[model samples]
Target chain A: MATIATTPVLPATTRTRRGHAERPSAFGTAILLLGVVYCLLPVVWVVMASTKNGSELFSTFTFAPSTHLLDNIVELTQYRGGLFWLWMLNTAIYAGVGALVSSLVSALSGYVLAKFDFPGKGVVFGILLMGVLVPSVILAIPQYFLLAQIGLTNTYWSVLLPQLISPYGIYLARIYAAAAIPTDVVEAARTEGAGELTTFFRIAIPMMAPGLVTIFLFQFVAIWNNFLLPYIMLGDDHLFPITVGLSGLLNQGATVPALYTLVITGALLSIVPLIILFLALQRFWRVDLAAGAVKA
Target chain B: MRIAFKAGALAAVAALALTTAACSSPASTGDTDGASSDSGPVNLTYWAWAPNMDKVVDIWNKSHPDITVTVNKQDGGDAAVTKLLTAIKAGSGAPDLMQAEYQKIPTLVSAGALKDLSKLGAASTKSDFTAGAWNAVTLGSSAIYAVPQDTGPMMFYYRKDVFKKLGLKAPATWDDYAKAAEVIHKADPTQYLGTFSSGDPGWFAGLTQQAGASWWSISGQSWGVDIDSAASKKVASYWGGLVQKGVIDNDPMYTPAWNAALNDGKQVGWISAVWGPGVLAGNAGKTKGDWAAATLPQWTAGANANGNWGGSSTAVTAQSEHPQQAMQFIKWLNTDPTAVKALAQIANIYPADVHATDSALTTAPDFFSDQSDFYQVAAKASAAVQPFTYGPNVNVAYSAYTDAFAKAAQAKQQSQFLSALSSMQSTTTSDLKKSGFSVK
Candidate 1:
């Protein structure tokens, strides 16, 4: 109860200390903009390249926009009764939900491991840390066999199930939990007679919210950008993620040059939501690596 | 608000649960007894990768009464193989009929993954097929795995206008071809007479077959390292000279350089397999009428006259529920003249059926102007094509050769390139021999 009263006071004092004005770092802003430009070059090329007809694509300057973007979209949409859109939807389902579940699992697992002394605690932590170093590509063959044994290969579960356990995600969450949640708060809640589950839900999760967002975004991008695992796992075209689907288009672009336009357009479209997500979530990124350090 | 967020999350989770519930469960039992509705009309599942030939399936489905074939355009060959391998490993999930490449059959068959088409009753029909194309589909003497779809008869295609401008006829031999290329390059500094992607040793393999060399033994067993062989050295030195002399516009396959050559019409001629016509058409407004066909320039006095490059086949997987139906479809697609003709028109493919039509040889289309009937030209070139024995380690070996060839081309190293190719071939041979192929 004393800590709960003081929590409101601490935030007000911190806000007052920051109320007047803070000068932005000129060099930092410039460096960040430079980084933004470096990343945006390829994306910008794809957007402009997609607009040109096959003949015009290589004929004109690489960046000079052309009139065929709408035509390319129409062609791509009609390629197989809007199968591209279906792929887009499947990818959204896979990445969006896969990341959500993975983030939740990471958060819950991390919170418990960080805040409590459970049985086999050290073993779990060590194993999860090792999992972070293990490459997903190495798991693809084994995962395929395991999934195939259960008759799960070629279905949506084939892709979704393997991606649900994010090792890096749990690692990040553990770090975040340790940094954000205070052991004293958990003890105080326990003294007030809150059950372990109740303490986790009411006290720890909210404190860990910002870190969880970072975990969610990290997992989201990892799953979204992933090509090899889904490419290896999902046999059905209808179940393909955008990366796999776009690469398929590019392969045909070898024989069918007309497909180049569709591939470029699809590539451009795939990255749009990702860029938006990053921009929207920038506020959660740590400004200083030491900002979360605690006082003794 | 907190309750609302949790409720929203719960609802999303519930939606996922609902969707997963709706997904078709992995078949609880193998569709083995041929049990999926002979009563309500048989639904045959066929898988292919042709983005343009979905209509061929629809046309076939509309034409057939007893069986309705639903063709699903799967991903590329590698993806399809990976899927099929997984399914084969599962012992149940493979499609009823699948379009596999002729080159892939050797590996697939050796793996014991495909249902023997000979068992499915296509043995005699497959025998009546063109020997070279059919050989590409067969795995050794016993197991006939796939039925040939189209024969990729290697032919030399030249830009008649460009050839005329350079005052040269289409070269009749490899030496002549190289000399003519040099002449053309000399005549126009900017225009090279020919270009080939060295990165794809498939053409080299075909050339080797033409020059009486086999890269691997069929039983997945032994390999012949022709890289250091007299004919192979000649082949490498000849092509290398063209690149070194700067007479050939070197365009690696699927690169911007290759695409630019097509768009600009810079290369005078290209030697490609029969399937190259479709590749030309697929490029649409590019390369239209700028090309004409001739027999693949042979190595003068070479043991073999011509050889196949790229072709594909259809086969029944071991997991197929209805092997008979699968064979029927493959037989109709490959050996039936009428079906082959229909597919040719729709897909612009030259049929694998040796007897499909002599007209397939001579029907002069305006696209090539006086390129004559493509079928007849291809038929002539199809002769002297010895069987290409694809080693079981063909995929890995080819990748090795490709890597070596790339480094050689870029770095100008010849001995290293030959050594790399030899090692790759020997490894493949050894792997195949271990896998039970009879390699001499």
Candidate 2:
């Protein structure tokens, strides 16, 4: 055994040095815990606060929970035949499908700018970068007028169409594609008689999958939390999202105090679906600045 | 795998097609309802803020079954105005019957968004309503715009028990009112004889109106500002002195501090409009049988002290298809004594109609206690109300005067107050001109 140990192909010195370096540093653990607590504090408060009655909401300490959660939910369900549920369904349709369609357009548009040598590519990229700074709210009134010109105001398309063009998503996709897809691999695929579209489908897309997941998540959350756009665009109550619906209930609470519980319960129900989606898809999120920096 | 994705895409396409098909059905059903493109049961949608309108709608819905009435409950004043302006710009799905507040009619009319209702059928009932109330809905001599629904008649409300304990009688003159405050404060170091809130523009307007000062005026081509008028200056100075002397507490609505003060009965009296009993009932357990009502104290003794505070009117929009049906509902809600009485049961909205004052509902005892007859007090105050012109920029003038008066009271900024008042007057005059109101 001593003679056999005389010559090992790999050196023990390098392996030992790497092993003794560190075992998950405490600083990294602390930083991650701090980040999580910062993000979840508001949500924790909302969950506890929803359980309290109106008097308890103001009288008790901020985060203390009371025994009114189920009672609040039942009262909210009885308000005008559960119109709150209609708002929830409307919000889901707006965010879920809106984000999905936006992701596809962004992915395809970004892939083109990254892989192809198109005319005026620099100018196109510059215009897209400019779009990132223009706030969505500023465009709402103008968008409303434009839609009204063709008689589309108060329609689902008025909201859904304006959100589809996400310039930031395109910018992210282009950056991810440039780093993730290897140039030599593309050349080799081409030499093997694979067409451009074929190579893109089989190779480039798979490499960009992780980055695309991050893009989809960003777009989903942005659309889910949007309120002002829908508020300005739609006039019909039946077409309102959860945010608008909850606000109407809150306004009524000013004159009638009993509606306060309904507002709180509606607010609680509104955020549950988004939280579940966030938790389930969280593992796919590559938080590293460079998700494409993997070794072949 | 590609075929499955294509199938999913096809399904989305099919869904879109179905929704498009569904939207067209409402358009086609219109012809069958005997609504010729022009004269069929015109869909007149009404937007009202008060809960009382719900009772009025139930009555109207039974009579005018042909006209489809969709009631959209909206907040009154600024919030409602914002929504209306946005809807008008959108040019579709506008409410047919819209409720406008007393002070907001001029601002709304100037925006060119309302129907010219001078020719509407409610014209004959104009004389029957209170003079001050009808004046708000009429812009000029010829352009009568809306049907008056409710009126606010200002009065002084006091805690009868608190007054008796302090051994003081309710003052009939402004001087006596001041003396009573001193006596009450001497009796209990904590309690003031009355309360005043600087933040409320409506309260400031009521004070100025009680002193016989017009907030806005139109003279040929220039507008007159009344912030510097002798009557207004006296009213502001008297209230400002009370604030400085520490005999009055300034409390806005719904604050924790305000709520606590209300429950403790630190303020023995309050001067508010016909619906102020609503405010009293809001704090039910705090002041059950302790309250009493009287006419407001006068500056020049035996003056017209009563002034309107909050009221509303209903008008049909130009876009409405069923004008007849909408008017049918509006007339019932505004002029009918039975309907008005039924509404008063649900909400404390005192009707503008003189006949409504005679209703048996007005004699109903207080729900909180049997010690007071609120409707009689409101009716007496209503009979003494004085009308003032609310120009196109009435709100702007109101804010200007309130801010100036508050500064003078809160900070002792006399020179600054005068300058601010003049500045606001000039700005309001210009704003009125831009809005096509003859500012002179």
Candidate 3:
């Protein structure tokens, strides 16, 4: 979801910055306005819909805001003794720890692949890249089978373990490593008799900090937004991530309409944390850092 | 550089082949044989996914002192089956009993995952269920695999106020319904006497079955697909004519647009299953007390025959060691008067039991103006539904029909509908055959 949501903004924001550097063009402003509206429309709908009771959701005009926002939130919180909060916490644990570990693994792997001159180095990088092309969803069922064989499924470890080896993250880290971590600096660090591990942790890691953060942000959002894996893996509601929990609630809406209100309110609440995370991570965009690395 | 990259890529692809090694190998079901410990009271694990099911489970636990069953709520519908299939293939974590839609019974039976309940006295309880519901849970002659639960008998619900203004009485047959469509459309171009949703093929199937179209059947160890039968052709033309002529509104149901249309009285009534009343009340809250229900429009003069839409049943998995206790719980849950009454509140439908005389099905909903008896009409339809079977290919059939009908709705051609039906028929046949079933 973060990947998709951020896609249009990357190029658009770049264009806007150039426009500010020069003279603002009306055409550019119009396109920016269109993009803004396109991205915000669903959020606007969720806000308006969350303010409606079950019946008013369909009967009233879509944009009309009702007075039931608080009521809807109360109902959502009360659903199964505030199970919504549990789903949120489970998601945070999965995404938070999963992304942290994934970024480290990707960084170290990518660093080694990029800097080392070893046999089968290119093959390791190629296989990791090939892994990216194979859709993640295909891996989920087979992963389930593998995990179930060892009795690891239906546990937090099930979700966390599969997500930690993100092929795309490895690919991105490889790109960042080649571009940002110059071999010269690492060679110089090694000449000082520092251990290879110390050189990586002290020099290459600090230099690759922005890139790792970028990888972390991508992975965090990917695991946070994933629905199918958790839906297939976890049977216990207590272990459900927000996506599966909300989707189950949504399906129940076919029989119980009031659940629709809860789904809308829950959706509105779910985005708040991700939005804050994005806002906080704005400095990791690394356009300046990359430019400095290229100059060096 | 480029040559090394190419060789490296080849080697990587070769190395990656290890991941596919386990694809062919299936994991054995683990140590889940919990039903073997005798002497002590039997602890049964039941998996179900209906709303308010815990309340009913509590009632069952309270009544049966000797047998205590623990309920595990799993995702319902197809996801439930996927999980069950995985667990069954693994040979572990299979619940003692599970609830699934009746159409899914054949798939589980063919996979040899479901227990044949003939050994557990399911044969004696055949008369307790609606014949159609009973037929749904059974194989060729005797093997009853699941205990029938709630049923969704097809019925017609209408906005009584809109119909009264349009001088339209409850349609007794399809001909009268079409004629009413003409009247209503001529009076107000925006108004329709009835509607047909191309997206909901189950609704079409019910209508076709009402016209005596046996699209699916089972003979001696072989399945038959007759979706393009003459009766189905008649159903297509009858509804297709109304859809083409713009007499009946073709607004798709269960969407925001459809809800607005219903609230605006764009269609005088709706033809759907017993569950339609609850769905309508949920969607059309403003138009409450202005609606009523009648039996699905008959085909023959004063004749009575209908078709079911959605319902589910409880079946014991083959993994269960205590089939007798599982059967007792299933029968009690479905047939016990108190249990059925409790279930009615949870599912909000008529239980499959024909003899459970719960007056709730007869009471007029506040949304229906207290003028029309929704559940009583549904009960009549349930009794009239012929004992028909949905084969294992029903899911594949439904998806194919969905795509085909979406085209027919857009094309607005009877030939298109026939072509779609034929395509679905062939697909269902081949799919069933591919699954190692003898399909003719």
Candidate 4:
């Protein structure tokens, strides 16, 4: 009788497990789908609007696509003798260089804090935690004042320097490093006569490759989307990033009509590189998530 | 580890050296003054928002090689002023020249951002501009602050096709305008004569100006705010009654919805300024050759009075070391026949120079090709603008107007509109006093 009861309970548990696997929460999925539609609607609108010329933009249907995308791009490219392309180049330099250096600094700092038992390390981490709570927008005016004191307010360095030390990036790196890079590897490398910098660059850095890529991608997108810092720091349009440059096109003043078509097209073109970068680096994110699962 | 420490220390030293080098470089370049006997080429930077201003400066750059001006186009009036004020407070990084609006001159002067140009031969160009335009830069004082670049004299624009279809003539008085609005709305529920734009404080100020209202005045070191004066209240109530009666739409201008309204002929008229053609052509391109310009409907019949709207002036900043050269560039930019002509043609602005109408604006804009006398009507309206004074705290007043009127417009209440004016008056006066200005 006991064996028969146990056999019935086991089959019931299996049946419940299969049911859970086969069915999803309908209400939860409806909310999530609503959120997705809300997020994607504006992007779809921009894509559709960019294809319409100035005359057809407001008069036509909101979602109806037109054939003026190429014409709009050509006009935007010809604006002020191809100044929009210069803005794109400036954005690339700022985000590309800024993210690379930021990730390197974050990796070093985070790895040392995770592995090393240095004095005042708690104080340093506490300060970093506090910094993570402070919004970056509040820092722009003060950064502008500081840069002005050094006579570097309008230069490219003014924008690059302030973004290099993101506290949140370092914190993220710390969590990632503690989980990914084992201390045993560093000690083994040291026992093999590898120098401190040599071990960090060769052993720990390689072990933390997926994580560093995550940090790099995060910083890259942040710097790319940053507007207030560069807007306040740089005075010269030649030094302006795409965000500031596109804003200038729209706010040409009360008298002149805004360059709506060019701005819309520029916005669409600006997102293409971001999409490509995401697709390229998405594999790294997958590998990072799966690494711990494989170890378990 | 020791090698790493040494490398880091060396890098720190290098960064210090670089910063010092940068600090000294700007100081040396910024020290040279045009007042000095050095005939060296002066590189002046101008912060302006007018389109194709670079082309206008190209003309000057070719002729005056000694002082080459580079135009750094900025976002419109308020944003550029905020940036300029920040730079002025920093004691560096300000452009040599800025496009100052007439209302902002008082604020800029009070902040010591603008250099008084009267001592630098700006007085000679006074006769070139209208008296009302000149009065704005001077603040009713002896000190001249800016050169008038353009003026936006308020005018009435209506769709000729729509008016003809309805068998209605253009209204010449506010009473007639109300009757026409009722008739048009009764004929078609989707159509309206105009809209009450609460988002634009400048537009409201222009309407009040036509009613002989000066919102601000200064007398012997004291400021006066009269935002809720009888004249302003009259203008507000008139617009509010129309909105409440549902004859006019209580929507803001310069929005996508309004653009659509203008395009589809739901909005049949626009109470805009001389610069209206460019806006109409850009927004309602299909409606071209079907619109005509006339003077704003009179408060009293045959009054022939008008008000000013969007316009800007060129001012030299106090931080500029090359004030002399900066003054020369602005004078040429505003008054030179070729430069003013370029401003009208390429930049598409109504030049503030009194003689600009005689020479530069002989032809009508393409949008109003049907109305050949557009500029003539504009010039007549420009000559009739009443004098208005702007206080140092116009920004506070303007923002208060947006806040109070936005709610009133939403509620569609006439009493709320009048109360909005009182709120604006109190907000402006209190802010002036809070900022340590004596408000009476």
Considering every candidate listed, which one attains the maximal TM-score?
A: 4
Write one digit per residue (lDDT tens) for candidate 2, span B1-440: 23322222232223222222332243235324424534545556677766656556766677766665676665344556666766655656457788777788765554444655544466777866877777777644455667888777777878888889877787888888888888887788888777556556676677778788777764543445565567666766676666667666544444444544545687677777666666565443357678787778877787656777777788765445455556667777777766777657665577788888777344633632564466676677788876677765667776765676556656644444455456666767776555443434
lDDT of candidate 4 over B327-428, digit per residue (tens): 889999999999999999988889999999999999999999878898999999999999999987789999999999999998999999999999999999
Q: Estimate the TM-score of every prediction.
A: 0.84, 0.79, 0.86, 0.90
Docking class of 1: acceptable
A115 Cα displacement, candidate 1 (Å): 3.7
Please tell me the interface RMSD, in Å, for model 3: 2.9
Task: Please give the lDDT score for candidate 3.
Answer: 0.76
Ordered by TM-score, highest first, the candidates read 4, 3, 1, 2
Q: List the residue pairs that clash in candidate 4.
A: none
In the range B1-440, model 1's lDDT, one tens digit per residue, is: 23322232232323222222221122113334445544446667777775545677666677777677767666656668767866665555677788787767755654446665565577878555776666666555555678887666688777777888777887878888888888887887877776647566677777777776666542222334343466566666667766766778655666666656666776667777766665555543566887878778877734338877766788876666566666677777776666776667766666677776563434654466556566567677876577666654567777777776776666555454466566765766565455443445
Candidate 3 vs candidate 4: the TM-score winner is 4
User: Across residues A24-121, which tens digit of lDDT does each residue of candidate 1 receive?
Assistant: 68998999999999998887899899898777777689888999999988888887788888888988898889988998898888888788887999
Comparing 1 and 4 on TM-score, the stronger one: 4
Worst 10 residues of 2 chain B by lDDT: B8-17
On DockQ, who's better, 1 or 3? 3
Which residues of candidate 4, in runs, are more than 4 Å off? A1-35, A289-296, B1-32
In angstroms, give how far residue B185 of model 3 lies from its true place: 2.3
Q: Backbone clash tally for model 1?
A: 12
Best model number under DockQ: 4
Ranking by DockQ: 4, 3, 1, 2
In candidate 2, stretches whose alpha carbon ends up further than 4 angstroms from where it belongs are: A1-71, A181-209, A248-269, A286-296, B1-39, B52-55, B155-161, B168-195, B254-256, B263-269, B277-295, B300-304, B321-324, B363-372, B398-423, B433-438
Q: Please give the lDDT score at residue B395 for candidate 4.
A: 90
